[model samples]
Target: MPRILLIDDDAQLGEPLAAYFARFGLELHQATRPSEGLARLREGGFDAVILDVMLPEQDGFAVCRAIRAEGDVPVLMLTARGEVMDRVVGLELGADDYLPKPFEPRELVARITTVLRRRRAVPADARLRFDGLVIDPVTRSVERQGEAVELTGTEFELLLVLAREPGRVFGRDDILNQLRGHEAELYTRAVDIVVSRLRRKLEPLAAIKTLRNAGYALALRPQAHG
Candidate 1:
């Protein structure tokens, strides 16, 4: 069973969602406070996180950014505000997906299923080596010039897709579909944000490249470490 962490303040929502998720072999853990949520997350057994946008004290945006900075645990933002700008902000903060509030429980289940599925689908013995950079999909770890590089779940996934087919250009749409497993309402900038974050962490050995009027690609090899 996949374990999920739900960081929302409402027991009304959590009670039903928990019961619904149970039917699908999912274990739901609830945290009503941001601090508590972060604590539970630090314990490290969750497959994905469902965060509410209107949490008390710190809003979901701050919470999401903090979570992304720590690691790439998948996040699905739940919000009563369904504006495009709100969705864009959530995506930019490294959320894997966003679902508007008052949504069907079934839709929430589907989104959770997609994010978790994407997390597990990796090639066997899945390792990629490029010049001074090394990526092991099985371990979900990266190293640059023999030093370990910490990557969030989303950032790692993005890099894996690019590294899998080095030199092959992947448009934003292709990457979105590859990560989310569906045609989503994601702005192209979402891909850009993940790429930018990955680039910062994979620096010096910089293997990712951009194409004008095209898309992004991983260089066949990174620059030799000095």
Candidate 2:
């Protein structure tokens, strides 16, 4: 059974949602406060997190940042406001996906399932080696300049998509499609945010090059195979 942590302050949402999730072979755990949620996350064993924007103590963005700072546990943010800015902020903070409030529980399940699927999918092949960057899809690890680089799940996926095709300019829409499938509602800014985050993490490497009004491409030269 997949374990999920839902961080929301709604007194009435947890029980029903937990019961609903149980039907799909998912174990749902609830934490009403951000602090409590973070504590539970630290205890580990969570496959994914469902975070709410409106919460007591710290907001969901902060919690998401904290989670990314610690590890690459996939995160799905919930925003009752459903504002575009909210989604953008959440994605920029390293959330893997987001869903608006008043959403169908089944749709929520689908969104969660999609992110979890991406997180667990590992390509069977050799490692990708660039000028100063090395990516191992099998292990989901990245190394830059001989040092291991920690990246969020989404960040790692974004890098892999580009590194796989060096010099290929992928427009924002192209990246969005690759990362989140054909989710038309997902804005292009989400791709920019994730790319920005990935760029910052792989700093001084100068791997990703932005094409003017075009898109982004991996500029790193591939290391020759022996």
Candidate 3:
């Protein structure tokens, strides 16, 4: 069963949605406050989070950003405003998807199912040989020259994005959008931070290449073989 954390102030809406998801074999954990939600996120070991944008105190955007800073859990944002800017901003803030208020329960279930499916579909191949480094995405592990190296969650996601498509020149915005999910807030240096962190971990192998202002790409060293 997939575990879901729902952060919304509207008890009426939350209750019904929780009940609806429960019928589908999902375990829903509800939190009406931002602080409580964050706490649950850290401690509850959930698969995904459904956050309402109009929460008291910090709001959903802040909560989402904070969570992104910690891990890459899929986040689905719910906003009553339904404005394009709001949707864009939510994507820029690292939310996986966004749904406007007054949405159908079925639609919510569908979105949740889609996100979970994508997350689970990430391949478990023992090793991804990119450039000179080998990455095991399933285990969150990496190896260079037959030696293991440590990487943080953000670094691993960044590397996974680039290595998944070698020679592809992904723009910073595109990389950020991909790794952070569709609903991340735009930041001038967010991609740079992730890249910089990745570089530090990959420096030993020097497989990842920066494409000047275009973005970053992964290229295998001529002599390095799988």
Candidate 4:
């Protein structure tokens, strides 16, 4: 069973959703306040999180950052129907997916499954495929649209990091530690520079998306065969 945590002020939504979720073997836990929600999350053991954009205490973005700082848990943000900025900010802040309000409960379940499906505990092989983009970690190679995309060692590692978990956002410091095993420098723009260079090589295929004030994530996958 997947244990899903809901951080929202609407206590009314819990019982019904919990009952509805139970049919699929999902256990639902609700926390109305961000502080309490964070505490519960810190206690651990949640398959995914459903966070509301509007909260009593800290907003969902802050909560999302805190969650991402701890680990790569799949987060699906609930936002207003037209809050374009909120959705962008949420994604930038490491939200695995987002659900605008006025949605059917079944749609929420579908979104949760979609995000989780992209995340596998172990790759079936060293080759990772997202749509038409293929990354072979063993060979340290990347291919797009039947052509090769050459990347620097750092760039390849960075791409590999983001591609490992398609929708998970990675902060600059996290990338630094993974790539160079050190802290990020205040004056350094190395990560940005590398990303820019990489973007050039990976043209026509929008594989990476930048999350401003946060980091980056892999957005595009290889297209499926007809």
**lDDT, each prediction:** 0.84, 0.88, 0.76, 0.76
Model 2 C-alpha lDDT per residue in residues 104-217, reported as the tens digit of each score: 899888888878888889887789998888899989999999999988888988999998889999999998888887854657888889889899989898988999899999
- Put down candidate 3 lDDT per residue, 43-136, tens digits, no spaces: 8589999988888998788998888888778888898753766666676666766788878888788878867865676575556775467787
Give the per-residue lDDT of model 4 (tens digit) for 24-105. Answer: 7789999999999889988988888999999987899999988877766778889999787787677566565677897789
Candidate 2 vs candidate 3: the TM-score winner is 2
What is candidate 1's lDDT per residue for 77-191, written digit by digit as tens? 9977557666778877878888987788888898899888878877685478888788888788898889998876678888888987888999998998888776566568778
What overall lDDT, based on C-alpha atoms, would model 1 receive against the true structure? 0.84
Q: What is the lDDT of candidate 2?
A: 0.88
Worst 10 residues of 3 by lDDT: 217-226
Which should have the higher lDDT, number 1 or number 3? 1
State how far residue 56 of model 4 sits from its true place (Å).
0.9
Better of 1 and 2 by TM-score: 2
The alpha-carbon deviation from the true structure for residue 88 of candidate 1, after best TM-score superposition, in angstroms, is: 3.7
Off by over 4 Å in 4: 127-226
**Which sections of candidate 1 miss by over 4 Å?**
69-71, 222-226
C-alpha positional error of residue 14 in candidate 2 after TM-score superposition, expressed in Å: 1.5
In model 2, which range of ten residues has the least summed lDDT?
A: 180-189
